[model samples]
Target: GAGVSQSPSNKVTEKGKDVELRCDPISGHTALYWYRQSLGQGLEFLIYFQGNSAPDKSGLPSDRFSAERTGGSVSTLTIQRTQQEDSAVYLCASSFMPQGSGNTIYFGEGSWLTVV
Candidate 1:
């Protein structure tokens, strides 16, 4: 059973550029979620997909941020036009159920994004 994983561990881009971050959830997990944590800030929910339900993207900061989950497993978060404010650690987590209560989410190390 592989744990959640994220690619590029770190990403550096300029303003107005586009960046794509990838996530691989644990095997057999039915729920996946994306979150962003800026330096010295709390985790902000981005999007989530569970089973066959429609994804919840309410937490996405802006229209520039979008994501998709393929085959109920892997997911990718794409920033259409990167900005300095978009720079943060992108974290992905998966759980056995759609939502975990009491802080049961297992998070990846996160993909650090830097916009210069």
Candidate 2:
């Protein structure tokens, strides 16, 4: 991964087109997480959210994507009408873990969404 950027982030959108994305916040006793995927692309983020109790609700937004905790383990991220740009690998992260902690944000396997 290239690492975080200092430049101001951009949140641009077009006309009536819809986009979708997914993510998994962290879930743990100490509020820690680990992102296993590489952010080779950039520091881009998610769309909306749907879930009751995400360990870290901060990472998710209630408008674009949805997430949920199941069976006391593992999380799910689902986005509807995914955009063509969303075809990139999906990354899930948790702000639960504090800085400097061994347990950092965790990324899921690439979403591999196809917008056909």
Report the number of clashing residue pairs per model: 0, 13
RMSD of 2: 9.7
Ten contiguous residues with the weakest lDDT in model 1: 96-105
Compared with the true structure, the alpha-carbon lDDT of candidate 1 equals 0.88
TM-score of each: 0.92, 0.43
Write the residue-wise lDDT of candidate 1 on 2-115 in tens digits.
Answer: 689999799999999999999998888888899999999999998888963446889998999988888988888999889999989999999888664543578999999999
Residue-by-residue lDDT tens digits, candidate 2, 8-103: 121233433444333334444223222222246564454222233444445443445565544433455554444544444454444434445664
The runs of at least 3 residues in candidate 1 whose Cα sits more than 4 Å from the true structure, single-residue gaps closed, are 100-103
Off by over 4 Å in 2: 1-40, 45-52, 55-62, 93-100, 104-108
Question: Total backbone clashes of model 2?
Answer: 13
**Which 10-residue window of candidate 2 scores lowest in summed lDDT?**
1-10
For candidate 2, what is the TM-score?
A: 0.43
Provide the RMSD of all predictions against the true structure, rounded to 1 decimal. 1.7, 9.7
